[model samples]
Every structure is written in C-alpha cells, then in structure tokens.
Target chain A: MTDRILAVVTLNMDIVAGGAPIFFARNQEEQVKMARYLARTLDAMVHDLENGVYIIVKH
Target chain B: MEHYLGTIIAGTLAGTVARMVMLRLDYRQYPGYPHGYLSHLSLGFIASALGAVAIPAILKPDYTAVTFLALAASQFREIRGIERKTLEHLDENELVKRGSDYIEGIARTFEARNYLAMACALLTGIAYELGRAPAAIIMALLSIIFVRTFMAGETIGDICEVVPAKLWFKDSILMVENIGFINIGLKEIREKITAEGLAVLITPKNADARATIHDLGQRQAMAHTVTVLLGTKKDVDLPEFTPLARIDPDSGAVGLYAVPVERDIDALILAVKRTPVLESARSRPLKTQAGRMAAR
Candidate 1:
C-alpha cells in the first residue's frame, strides 16, 4: 500500500489546501482531538507539519 | 544390493540425524510446527537415500543411478522457492514484517541445510565402505559437527554492538538519544512513548558492517525481529506504536524505537543482538582498495 494524505487537521486554515479533506480547529486541543479521530477512522498516522498543521497519512 | 545394505542404512541414519540437528525451533519461529518438521524431515530422508545409493550404483557399474543426485539438487531448489512463498504469504498479516532480505536468507539456509544432510550421508557411506561401522560413526559425527559450526551464519551481535538509548521528545519529534526518530502529533501518544518506549543504538564494528546495516531491508529485519521477540504494543490501527529503525547518516549507526508489551530493556537488547545478519544485506566494501582508502 502507498502512503496518502487522508486528511489535514489544522489551527490555521491558510496553511494547508488541496485534495485532502481539511479540518480547521479553534485551538491545539481540538486539533489533537480531530486528528486522533480522523487517524482512528482512516487507520492512518498523524504527522505534525509543525506549522500549526497536522496531516493524517495512511502508510 | 545385499552387500551394500549396511552402508546404505548407516548413511541414511547419519543424514537424517544431521538434518534433525540443523532444524531448530528458535525465536525466528519459522518451520516451528509439526507439519513443517514432517515435510523437511521427509525430504531429508529422500536426500539421504539418494546420496547413499550413489556410491553403490557406481561400484555396480550402474552409471545411470548416479544421475539421481542432479534431480535431488533441483528438488532442493524447489524447497527454497516453497519457503519464500510461504514466508511472503505469512508476512502480509504480520504487524511487523520480516523483510524480503530476511526471508531470502531463511530460504537459502533451508536449501543449504538439505545439501549438508546429503553430504553427511555421502561421507558416511564412503567411510562405511572403506573401514566398516566404526569409521562410519566417526565420519558421521565429524560431518555433523562441521555442518553445525561452519554452515551457521553470523548474527547482529557478531558485527555490531547494541546499547540502550534514552527516548525523549523534541516537541512533536521523538528522539532516540541524539538521533531524531519520528514525528508524533498526538500529545498523549507522544507522552506514552516518552514514558515507556525502548530505544537502542546499533553501532557497527567496522566500515563493512556499517554498509551492511545501512541497508533498508536489514533495518526492517531488525525492527521485525525486535517486535516479534518483545511483543509489540502495536495493533493494525495503532500505527503510532509501530517500531522503527532509523540510521544516522553521519556515523552510520542505527537507532531502533519500539513500544513493547514487555517493557524489559535487557530482553529487547538481546532480541536485537540475536537477529541473524541477512546475507542479502551483507556488504564487504573493505575488500576493495578504494573502500580501504576511504576507511583510512
């Protein structure tokens, strides 16, 4: 299986854009919660872009 | 044929015993079940029979019977293919995979063991024909000892040193001592890893070993072996807990990170050290002049 960006969870909406589904959270807590949920649902890993964005990747 | 009965029996017994001595149910755990053992032992018996018949056939001036040894060689090649297929099928479901290199190494070893068994039988037959039962017994023991010692390959510990390393978090990035491992975005998961995860640095003894461990397949084999022995906390969905082996490009050292069910550091180190060095991953650069100059 190839790695794909399943979703993007971010505090800042301006940082990420493109084909992957994006979710914007109000703060770090909500972003972590959303990323964890998306990761569980998608069976993917949450990688921090470290730019107020977390990308959920299926590897 | 009656005159050769004792020679044939002695040779076949020695060959089968040699195969049994080589077949071990080790931590690698392949061919561990009864069914696997039965199939291999049966093949060993057939190979021994083939080897035993060769000397008598030549003595009887029946040259055609000796051609069966060529057939035996082809059959052993099939054993290697069968082993590779079985392992590849099993790897699909493993949480941590024994990479292709490791699988190939295992397959090759299985094929070689059969040859060793055949050789043991042939030698015992020759000895029995020349000097009777006593010489045959001594030859069997010598050949079995040779197979056990010389046929066995080196392990990770033979070429590298495994030492425990501290796991820390540099923000979202997990660090194994000075080497940066992975980027874990989840705070709770990162905290769990920092608190419980085990890390180790595999330092190569020389340039040849450095190049060998630099192979991606070798690193993956190390990760798979460590996870299997230590019982990983990883599940299908829990990619965060999956073990990883990362290399330090500057020093050519590999760092392994794992969250095991049994949190024993000593066991983890032992498990890594015991992993067989994959033949496909072996690199001997020091043999070359340019490599020797670079090492200097």
Candidate 2:
C-alpha cells in the first residue's frame, strides 16, 4: 500500500472553481498529468499568480 | 448668530440642490450604468458646509471631538456592513449573466465612501475653529486605517500597532500604509528560496473572519498588497523588492508563482475563467453537408 493515501484530492484549475474532482496519484508525474488533463479543458488564467499554488486537493 | 443660521440654511439648500442635480443625472443615465458618481460629488459639497458647523458644535459644553467621531464612525461602520453574494463559484457564462452587476457593485462601494468622506469634510469645517490638526492627525490616521482596509478597524495603523512587520520591513510597510487608498491594501506574501528568484504568494482566504454587510463584494475581490521577506533583508523596500520577484530571463530565474494552495481554490480559479466558456456558450456556424464534405 502507498504511504501517501488519498488524503485530499483536488484539481489546480480555477474554471470549475471549488467543485472539481481529484484523485491521489502516488508520484509527481501522476500529479502533473492529473493537473494537465483537468486543466486543459478550462481556460487557464495566464497570470503569474497561480504558478506555485498547490490548489487544495479533495479527498 | 446670523452667520451660523446662514451656514445651516446654506448647507441644507446646497445638499438638496446638489442631490436634485444628481438625481436628474441618475435618471438620465438609466438603462446604462447607474449614475452613482453624483452621490460622491454632491455629498462632498454638502458635507463641506456641515463640517464648518462641526467647529462650533465641538465648543459646546457636551460635545467633544470624540462625539463627532462616534457619530461618523458609527454611521460608517454600519454602512460597511452589507451583503455580498459570492460570485467566486460562478462560471464565465454566469459571470456574463451578472456582468453589469460587478459595475453596479463598484459604484455602490464608491458612493458608500462618499457618505463618510463627506461626513468627515463637514466635520472638518465644524472642527476648523478648534485648532490646527486637532483631529487632523487622528483624521489622517483614521483615513489610513479606512483607506487601507476599505473597512474600519482593519486599517494599517491598527495592524501595524498590533503586528509590526519585522524591523527590516517596517519602512516599506509604512510606505504602503502611507500610499493607503492609492493602492488597494490587499496584501499577499511570497518569498524566493532559490537562486532563480521564484516568488509564490501564500494568501489563503481567511475563512474565519466575519462577513459583515460592509465587508461584502469589494473586500473579497482583491487583497491590498503582498509582502515577501525571506529570512531578512535590512536594505530593501516594497517597490525595490517587487522587481526581484518578477522572472528574469537573462538570469534564468523564475520570478513569481501563481498557484493557490487549497485544491478548492484552484477549482475556483479554473471555474471562473471566461475565455473558455464564451466559446462553449455559443453555437458554431452551420455548415452544408456538401461544404462539410469539401472541407473534409
């Protein structure tokens, strides 16, 4: 079993606001892909404001 | 005695006439943006006359400067308490549906200030006979407080007094507080740990603060400023330090990171972006079957 169980899962996209679904990927790549997949559909605000923010992931 | 009566009559008439003019303009501008600016202008003029009265009132046996302040402060504090619907969860289409609502909201916020600024100006005129800067310092300090927060009690004077920035940061912050209304007092904090100079602001929405009727809409939309102090920098200020946070291509360093921490926040940000939805909202042009085949 992975030590990093799905504590909280959330997408880093703002289009859906706070209602998007997310899953716990075990690694960084999983995190990035999960981010890209969910993010591509939304029109990302291209400001430097959201670059390093780890949007709260839902459990 | 004659001048005092004249002043009162003059103020009342001026306020009434000014309001009538504004109301007239307000009527004309309808079906477009609401003409709220009229309130600010009229209120300012009206209050200036009333402020002249405040001077004599202050000298009376019962009236203290604080009494005038209490009246204005209480009135303003009451106005600051207002209802603001959270449009944060709204999508682009919804945003457009209530698009004009934002402007209406902005106008409301401005006019509300007109009320207090007018009250203060009126009080100033009344207080004029008292002394130099009698309440001027207090007024300046109070203005700093109100302008910074756009709300009472959250002013920089209050904040700085309670929570002084690190000694190194005190001056830049004073500059910020001094700049006051010129810059929205919304602040975020970001710091860079790498040689690349990456800056990430960590501003979690304060979920615990009370949402007063006065605290609605405008206060929620933006923060005043962002303060970043990594370890210590004895030699820098806000503007001087701000540039350090921007990306420098020549040096291959990332300047600012714009991510939210709470997943819900990212969802919120992503959900609100309108550029994607406008395309989704409209129907595509119809194509003839033959034309579709030709294109394909």
Candidate 3:
C-alpha cells in the first residue's frame, strides 16, 4: 500500500499560505470564485488538504 | 516460458522506443536539458513494455500474424497523433520546460509509466486465457497499486482542477476582490513568474489580497516557501504596477530578499518550479464543475 504522488511542477513556485484572507470586491463566495479563476489562469493547483486550499502554481 | 519472454521483451522495447522517439522529438524542440537523459532511459523502458504487450498479444494467439498487422495499421494513427500533439507543445517552450524536466524525473524516475505499462501487460497476459473482465480486474488492481505507490509523498493537497473560478467560496476568509460580506474561505495562490536573465524568474503579476494567494507568513510552520520568484532586481514597484498588499509590484531583480511569507520548502519548490516537472504534474488534474468555468 505505498502511494507515491509524482509532482512535476513546471514553473517557479512560491507557496502563499492558505487561509490568508484576501478582500475581494463582492461577497465571500465571490472571493473564492475570483480566487478560483485566478488560480486557473495562473495555472495553479488548488489542493484541498490540511484543512485548506493548496493552490499550486503550474507555471 | 518462451512466449512470456517474448511478451516482456516486446513490451519493454515498445515502451522504450515510443518514449524515446517522443523524448527525442521533444528534446529537439527544446534542448540543453542537464538531467534529461535519465528521463529518456526510464521512458524508454516504459515504451518498451507497452510495445511488448500490445505487439505480442495479437502476434498469433490463433493467427496472431494477421491480427498484428491489422493492429499495427490501426495504431499507426495513435502513434502519429501522439507525435503531432507532442510537437505542438514542444514549440511552446515555456509550457513544456518544466514538463520535460519533470516527465524525465517523475515519469521516468518513478517508473510511473512502467508500472502502468506492466500492469497493462499482466492484464493482457491473463486475459488471453480468461475473458476481458478478468483482465480488467487485474488492471484495476494494478491501477490501485500504482495510485497508492504514487501517493506516498503526496501532501494531502489540492486535486487537479480544470476551471477553478476566479472567485472564492461565499464563506471564505481569503478573497482578493472586495466582498461586502466576510466568509471564511480557503486561501488561493495567485501570481505569475516571468523569467528575466539567468536565475531571475520574477513574479511580475502581483496580488493585493491574501485571498488571492496562500502566502507564507514569517512565523507559520507551513511557510517553507523554497523558490522565491526573483529576477535581476530585488523587489521594485513599477509605475504601471498596482500594489498587491505591501509588496511593491517590482520587476528589476538585481538583488535578493527572503520571501516575506511562509510555506513548505520542498513542496514550495515542487509547487513553483514550473520547469515542466511542475507544470505537467500541476496541470494534469481532476477539477470540480464549478471550479473549471471561473464563473462561480
């Protein structure tokens, strides 16, 4: 039962601590919605682990 | 025994050749990789295995000759397609830089493809005598094993998402845009790294909100941020740039400064090193519906 996850990151990464609040223009959900979009455009990996969203920057 | 040997050899060789050709084509488009040979070797093995399995199965299970020929012709399109697709990406150096290094490392180093190829081979081996269902079962087990083994170092992190909306959850703590209400939401990583000069990959696009990024704080244990997006300049705010928090949208990276944030070092490097090793793995994911569209 050995599970090995191969993570091949393709760009310069800087882990921004999750849960760090970002004040958006709309509502809270709107923030997540914006974050989610930016995350994708940035080609980020938004992981759900350790009780947070692990947004990986895929170059 | 003879048949088994033939199958294995065929599979291994096939995996090797296919991967090599692909690698070669990829390398030609983007060259000068310091540690790419190892990747080539591993992929070669996997390709060899794939070839071994598929080629032999129809080799004459009951008139394997005709079947093999037909299969070859049928598969030619697939092979060509793979090549064509690869070529298209090859030209996109920025996209594939990290991909090449990573595939060479992860796909080749970890034998990720080999396990897949071998599992498939085993299924094929057994299925010839049994029915396809039995083979599918074996393949499933192989896949499970592969998954588990592959997940060993996986930090329970984000799953691959296709369209992570540009918005946060309604009740999220992290949001860059101004939300009238405050909800506790998970943090997000935002920003882009544009390389300028040697050892100078800088994040030009800055974010003003923590909600946009899960930045490493000075005191957090989760702050092992390994790769700092630095270029020829340290941290400078350009006139055209808007401030993302206190960080001045700087680009002239001539100096170095400790990233004033927190996150894991290994994982940070793993997360940011978009050298292809990071990109392919980072991009290859399974995202939820709401996440992919960006509309939220």
Best lDDT goes to which candidate?
A: 1
Give model 2's docking category: incorrect
Where's the lowest-lDDT run of ten residues in candidate 1 chain B?
Answer: B24-33
The best-first sequence of candidates by lDDT reads 1, 3, 2
- How well is each residue in B37-101 modelled by candidate 2, as lDDT tens digits? 45345554554445445544654443664366456545444433321232223323221122333
Worst 10 residues of 3 chain B by lDDT: B237-246
lDDT of 2 by residue, A1-59 (tens): 21221222233434323333434555545554554443333312111122322232111
lDDT of 1 by residue, B24-62 (tens): 623274748889888989998988888887878888889
* Candidate numbers, best TM-score first, in rank order: 1, 2, 3
For model 1, residues A12-40, the per-residue Cα lDDT tens digits are 88777899898999999889899999999
DockQ in order: 0.82, 0.02, 0.04
- Chain B structural similarity (TM-score) per candidate: 0.97, 0.29, 0.27
Each prediction's Cα lDDT score? Answer: 0.89, 0.30, 0.33
Q: Which structure is stronger by lDDT: 1 or 3? A: 1
Q: Which candidate wins on DockQ?
A: 1
Worst 10 residues of 2 chain B by lDDT: B159-168
Name model 2 segments beyond 4 Å from true. Answer: A1-59, B5-36, B39-50, B56-69, B83-255, B258-296
- Residue B10 displacement in candidate 2 (angstroms): 9.3
Candidate 1 residues lying further than 4 Å off, grouped into runs, are B25-31
